[model samples]
Target: MVSTSTTGVLVLLGAPLGNPEDASPRLRTELARADVIAAEDTRRLRRLLSELEVVPGAVITSYFEANEAGKTTALLERLHDGKRVAIITDGGMPSVSDPGFRLVKAAVDAGIPITCAPGASAVTTALALSGMPCDRFCFEGFAPRKDGERRRLFTELAEEKRTMVFFESPRRVTDTLRAMAAVFGDDRPAALCRELTKTHEEVRRGGLAALAEGAEADPPRGEITLVVSGWTGPAASEATPEAMAAAVAALEATGTDRKIAMKTVALRFGVSRRDVYEAVLKAD
Candidate 1:
């Protein structure tokens, strides 16, 4: 049994994305020594513990999205009592688009010490396998489910210079790719990483349009992560008024609303919407 501190520490455990061997030694030790274990899925946690061959003596409780808000206070009470509380998710680190954010924030407000056992993350794994520039990147947890919202998001990120990573459902991957192709341009380079670190893991590299087509032909299964190359177009400052107007006109020709087309062009070119509007007027 590990010694406990006077003030309990919140240990954020990183569950392996898929492979059990990827679990860190420190994570194993923490699992065995925790006073209480809060898991996103108790069944999954059981499978993991069985795989790791570690018998945890801690009191295990389910801490998932639905009950996270209600359970945080009770967990905080345990922490105040100096019990080592470990938070584990289905995969990857807790609180990264997961259920632990609320508890983490509550613990922070309560002045509890927090630490983590870092392990395999799909974000970095897919990013590494993507063959895109990794020096700079952003993780957009999951694309919006709604068509309009998702398109708007892609439009806003159209000019992002950093490589982008996104988690997407298998069913929506193809559609999401098509939406991305529409806003980020058909020729933009991208990679689709599916079932990462698992037996049937696969990575498909191509332009957004090609990816969409391939996915439509043969739907991918398991968890999906997308890595898209950032915009490499001329800087917004270098964009001439004529160029902005032409871009908006192109979108408008595709049946996009005039105002919305102007906004999309502005975002794609990294210019003010007003500038795109003025350019359109001058072109007319």
Candidate 2:
């Protein structure tokens, strides 16, 4: 250990989200000087250090979600003993959606000096490429995995005017997007950013329904970021049954499955599923 900690310090370093080169100089310096590296995944951090080619003199320790409640006090004890500990998650900034929040809260309550290494984030990456406004946006992280909770999340954000960013897994992308389309709308402009900053990086921009259907047919692998456009107030025809049917048809026009379309129409217009289904059938 370099003993850079005559005064204890905790630095939350942002690991590279995808491309290894995304590591920042500040991150390198922090990792180099940290007496203890509290990382979510020790092996991933090791690979990152190898990629950066910076051999740290610090002791590496694991600090992920599973053991955070137990490790918070121990890590705080190290800090209290005047050790400089650096925390890093697998990717993106720690404490954002990762395991560093509890530790950060503990340190702050104890009057510990805490700082961060700003680097690549899927939130910002997807937002910039999403062709959506970023000047004022909110990162919702990952929505709940369960359908009911996820639906409530979408409902809460249904009226959010600021551009929204979300992290989703591969297998659940379609389901999540379907829920988003339901609460937000089939015509709500959105983008699906996959494998950002990697070899097979792709950005598919369209309505939520379009991306959901496409991704369902060909499920995207690796990380998925959904940058959905802000609420636009009922898509011009929210007042009539015929208009709702037309909107559903438009969503279907973009290759969204009928079931997904029904979900969207039913939720967005605050109508029953049976009503939306009958309307779509009448349209046919």
Write candidate 1's Cα lDDT for 1-284 as tens digits.
98565789899999998889899999999999999999999999999999999999999999999999999999999999999999999999899988999999998998899999998899999999999999999999999998778877887898899999999998999989988876776668999999888899999999998999999999999999999999887465656899888777656554567888787777677778898889989999
lDDT of 2 by residue, 125-163 (tens): 888899988888988989898876786577668768899
How far residue 133's Cα lies from its native spot in candidate 2, in Å, is 1.5
Clash count for each candidate, listed in order shown? 0, 0
lDDT of each: 0.89, 0.84
- Candidate 2 TM-score versus the reference: 0.84
Error of 2 at 198 (Å): 1.7
Top of the candidates by TM-score: 1
lDDT of 1 at 282: 97
Query: Lowest-lDDT window of 10 residues in candidate 1?
Result: 247-256
